[model samples]
Target: MPRFGGPEVLELDRHHPDPVPGPDQVVVRVHAASLNHLDLAVREGIPTLKLTLPHILGCDAAGDIAEVGSDVTDVEVGDRVVVNPGVSCGRCEYCLRGEDSECVEYKILGEHLPGTYAEKVAVPARNVLKIPTDMDFPQAAAVPLAFMTAWRMLITRAKVRPGEDVLILGAGSGVSTAAIQVAKLAGCTVFTTSSSDAKLEKAKALGADVLVNYKAMPWSKAIWELTGKRGVDVVVDHVGEATFKDSVRSLRKGGRVVVPGATTGALLELDARYLFWRQLSVLGSTMANQREFEEVMKLVFMGRLKPVVDRVFPLEQARQAHEYLGRGEQFGKVVLAIDTPD
Candidate 1:
């Protein structure tokens, strides 16, 4: 898949085996891989990413260690683990200061480098998180990217407080599903928007306190009424240009809007007066730090946060998986299951 444009670009080709891991790397026998909106962006091609042709396109996975390089320590062959895609040079000043996501050379696994959509992938030992013995590969595969992005945006950047109200835009998105659960865990009331009734039902099952059908109601106005005209304490918005202004209007004075992506088009129009007068904060967050990843995964393992998987497709059906996700009807993560058993 060197080419770009649509899911058709994801062509399957058998090439030479992936090289053996270097000193600090390990090879994983991939079991399950999950999708994200970022996958769509990469498939369509982004301005910042300049990659070699025929790149892989998955960001989240859970697998067993097949081979370990000589210098690898703390992990061994047959160990079960999940891949954490956010990679940063440990020597960078930001990483040194414990802000790894802000590293000058931060890169993600599937986008910038070869990814785990294949049957096997090699990753730095530092980028792998050990999974609990009792968990399944598909469940573990759901944790890394979506949950981490949600955790960083809601907990770290937004500082979502207990008992507050939070609104998550686009209930069909993976991050939105994660946000609903995370917000509920924080003791917050969650409101979510969906274009479909079926998706709204699924969102409610995940602990959403209020559901707004964007087709039936003006979401911002509905949120205002749902909160008794006070609006919510925070809004988790990744819907971009289509919903950004509505997201802003749906917040209370001094409330914050945390954005981790722009799915619905990027260029947004805003009123300067609303931003200044309302004392609003628009926080931008990407992926999570190592500590955050560790913290959130612990919860996932403990069943405190469950990754909602919408569907799983075979690895060869990558194009179909992308098409399903691109349709925006999925209520949770769309995963690609590697048929090979580990």
Candidate 2:
């Protein structure tokens, strides 16, 4: 709890014994965690996050409970649960509308608040979703962030329909992987792009109807040709500065582009003319609302939607995990295994 800078700022040390649960919270011994590009950005200090120094930096995690607050009843100590991560005040206009992601005070675990990178984490009771007995911690940990995000974008925002063509801009990311599976499950034709053929093949295995090698094609012009120049119904563009313009071009007139994050860079040039001329709709999205989280995770639990995990690191090696994700070569989620009770 000392530094506030880079990965170097993430020094591990013992502060106290077990964390006490708040009136509406529970304490859990973290068993596993997963990384997102967001963690890297937080470590690098995103000015907008406005984090307190020495903040923990994990967003997705699962573990067995160690203790529960006196007021809690839905779960008990020893219950296995996945942390939802999204935090929002209960009474905002957005929350009232069930769009918790748009809450005026919306924040996420491991970002605006302390994260689950450590051996232990205390979270609001509302944040913990019970997992089926057969699911492992690593698998459960992968669901919250990526699945929720894809659910929000594909189902809620874009309202992607069956047989429609959907182009996912980045094939290697966790969200992209989830989108590929979810889009296919929704009976949509899914197209994904990856720099590596191996990753593209993996995307194909995960139900991608077509794979685009960005390294080979250079632009999405081929996507147009692949779709008979009709363009896709939706484009999931999180690659940001590098692919934003082409993403606009890859879509058909009135097509929707749902963006969750901009890994490359946030600032990008936009052609307003294209927006009006094509009657295109640019939709922005983030994590899902509570109902979306529940609906998407049900599929994960039932084995209908799968999470592709690239690798797992021990908690102490978070720095190494960050380095692995930094290479941008991983094909899916990178996880961290936190040792705890069964």
Candidate 3:
């Protein structure tokens, strides 16, 4: 969006030039781009972020390759692909061990670099994946950031075991929805919370075993009681200040809390006794590395893990799309359809 502050700051710049592929990058004709909480944070201008005024905002994109860079050899023009938003320095120590997200230069699309709100975006060739012919563009767009983040949080950081209990906070958001399914697929008993019953019902359809409305009762206590006071094996939380304390309380001894963001606010006053006495692990995570992204997406492509897309807005209505997500009404991802230019 042009300038940062609120949804009102979003501008449709029709005069924007189509991006050309760099030597190691390829240009995709973006058919769809999905929204994330990161988009909201960037639009409002996170303190550490310095933007160049006019910026396009979107992280997960799906489209066809319009042009391939001179050095690119894997995928060619006309390939149907989904963009992996994480960029990293391939020579770094973390990157060598396949931990691209931990690389010294690691950054995400729509965050450090130009993003995918436009009809075309140029990104590293290594960051694109070929999609099945049956996969729709909007579905592909909805899969990247949320699924990637949730995969790393539940699968890697928390190390959720089969038949274990996983409490996923904020059932309505994209990450929580994905976490519910991931936890269930891992054979974990999934517990999720939402303010709305409709969203809770939807979470059930996604295989969430226990659903709680935090508005009706304190979710930590509910989870505590549901698990017979044993607490859960793992807690997946993105709501930092509002729920971090409760998350720790809801975990059993040796349990781990995996987090991908702090939507409510980051500063948390955690009880040290809960951590030390309980031997709980608090793990911080971000977007996935390439291998993690591919692993989760394979499940998505096979129909085992579905991408939940709440709504789709045309590029011209981006402002309204941002407003909708800001209201926190969507149960999953809010997508933007990239209308082809005449």
TM-score of each: 0.97, 0.97, 0.98
Query: What is candidate 1's lDDT per residue for 182-206, written digit by digit as tens?
Result: 9999999899998898999999999
Overlapping backbone residue pairs in candidate 2 total 0
Estimate the TM-score for candidate 1.
0.97
Q: How many steric clashes between backbone atoms does each model show?
A: 1, 0, 0
Clashing pairs in 1: 2-54
Top-lDDT structure, candidate number? 3
Best by TM-score: 3
CA lDDT, every model vs. true structure? 0.89, 0.88, 0.92
Candidate 2: lDDT of 154? Answer: 92
Cα-lDDT of candidate 1:
0.89
Q: Candidate 2, residues 1-342: lDDT per residue as tens digits?
A: 355555556566666456789988999789999999998888888876676675787899999888899999998998999999998898989999998899999988888878888788888899898999999999889779999999999998999999999999879999999999999999999999877899989999999999888777765878989988889999999989988999999999999988889999998667999989999998999999999999998899899998889999888788888889988889889999987634
Question: Which one wins by TM-score: 1 or 3?
Answer: 3
- Give the Å shift of residue 237 in candidate 2: 0.5
